[model samples]
Target: MVTKESWSMSIWPMAPWKITFLIYQREKLLWIGIQMKVAAGAAKGLEYLHETADPPVIYRDFKASNILLDAEFNPKLSDFGLAKLVQLGIKTHVSTRVMGTYGYCAPEYALTGQLTSKSDVYSFGVVFLEIITGRRVIDNSRPTEEQNLVTWASPLLKDRKKFDLLADPLLEGNYPQKGLHQALAVAAMCLQEEAATRPLMSDVVTALEYLATNKDAGQGGILEEPEEGEEDHIEADS
Candidate 1:
């Protein structure tokens, strides 16, 4: 029986393989719907924060660690202590002291106290890298030059064929490959060096929704469809 305790491995971040294993339990048709909805919900929440809120708050520090998933695996953006509101006519929010997690901090914000909505986009980009690569923002264990997940994975993102690199090793090819790549593309754009280059969160949501709908329709997608027995395979739900 799937009890609250038993659902931890399936829902929590511990051992990404649990999620992969869940993906392996159901047919492509079943799990693909669930995955798209979960991811799209996350995209929509981000969009609401950027556009629906009164002043449009900036999620200064956005990372997977901050993203919490429920039993259904729906993604939710959390931790707003670092969140900032962008006031109209205010060119920038300046701080005498800069604050944020090291790896997720935007290069410009880290160097200067300037804060903008774009800074959050950069962090979101890093989160995307994490979700795709199944690697942390910073991994010191890797070789000298490959410590930063973005630095190591950006090139592979550029190469469409090499998208497989983004899959978590623990998954063993369980995720929808194309969907992962498409999500990576969204992340890559968010990580772009120039703040202006990054798409607005609203746009990001639309893109994700469109991608999800298209994937649902089987009309070719940025993400891929699930293989056989992907979802029902979750460790018998404990």
Candidate 2:
């Protein structure tokens, strides 16, 4: 007979999951600059996992819900149950069981069992799209053409003229258009069908870092800072 023991741990005491749908639904929580910050933070976290770990770890499941936000809105990654450690060897990719959220998994990983850091990159691209568009990865309630976010948005991402159509309406056209283009370009590269073509997490981190730093660049000549006493923790969607 085999014996098993289970332990429960509270990963997030007061912080909440950083689901873009919930964050954008709130009136004052969605800001272009803030979104950039969140993206950069998440990228840095993934970069650390891919590059700093003793034997690099592949975050098999990377999505908006897996990202958590503290009271200050700082992002942190959670749910390491599905994480896999890469062995120190000459192997280029790890072969494993296919597992992850439906709309966020990489096509190759979903079809085959091959897992790589790039799989996480693809999932990050989906979440990055969600943050930009303020939409869910898969929303059946939406119109037929708009039901699947990536399917509808991917074609439009390449054309700068159509970039505005993909932005979150809640932004009210207040974001820097140039920044939007740059961010979308990063997302597009990450979403590449070929896993080998996708940039490394370190590269992704650099791109997002630039976006976060220059968020105010094209903001129609008006850049306003948050008020001193404003609430930091916005209400989550029901």
Candidate 3:
């Protein structure tokens, strides 16, 4: 439990679930602006580890479930068992056995066992996509065509005409069109197939900060507070 003068945070303990579960709750919806705020906070946490740390750290297991939220929806990245420190000037990537959630791994890292900041970028893209579409990275219950979110959304992202289809339906068309376009563009850049093409976490932080601060990005809606005695934990899966 974390506390401040104004509010306290109780970490919710659940497995294989994510921020989306809370954001898309049936009773109350977390507005897009708030979601952007959480995203920016999480990105800043990652930026700190990747750029500010003495030895740049690779958050190899970044995902939504690993992001903890306080009473005000501030995000904190949790779970460092899979984190790796890079000798920035010496090595380009860490050679380790493939690990992390299946759907969130970067394609190159998954194939080569080469872990880097870009791998974390890929994972962030998946989580960001979840925030935008309110869908899981992989959902067996969904139709085969729509089961893999990145794959399903990839084509739609290319066509501006189909962009509206990407927003979380629970949002009920409450989000701003321009904001949705910008958000999807960020996700697409991070999800780039080539690790070298992905934007740095710093760039992501800058973009999300703008989106988060602009209340016009999404219509305000009710925000959900974490229930007492519930905390979320993210455990890496091989």
Deviation (Å) of 137 in candidate 3: 0.9
**Candidate 3 Cα outliers beyond 4 Å, as residue runs:** 1-20, 24-27, 30-33, 94-96, 219-238
Q: Model 2 lDDT vs. the true structure?
A: 0.75
Cα lDDT tens digits, model 3, 133-196, are 8788888899999999999999987887788799877767645666677788899999999999
Q: Which candidate achieves the best TM-score against the true structure?
A: 2
Global lDDT scores for all candidate models:
0.65, 0.75, 0.75
TM match of model 1 to true structure: 0.71
C-alpha lDDT of residue 202 in model 3: 98
How many clashes would you count in candidate 3?
7
Model 1 residue 195 distance off true place after TM-score fit, in angstroms: 0.4
Give candidate 1 misplaced runs (Cα > 4 Å): 1-38, 174-177, 216-238
Scored by Cα lDDT, where does model 3 land?
0.75
lDDT, residue 222, candidate 3: 13
What does the lDDT come to for candidate 1? 0.65
Better of 1 and 2 by lDDT: 2
As a whole number from 0 to 100, the lDDT of residue 234 in candidate 1 is: 22
Residues 115-220, candidate 2, lDDT per residue (tens digit)? 8889999999999898878888999999999998899998897677787787677767655556667778889999999999999999999888776665243321
The candidate 3 region of ten consecutive residues with least summed lDDT is: 229-238
Error of 3 at 85 (Å): 0.8
Ten contiguous residues minimizing lDDT sum, candidate 2? 215-224
Count the clashes in each prediction.
17, 0, 7
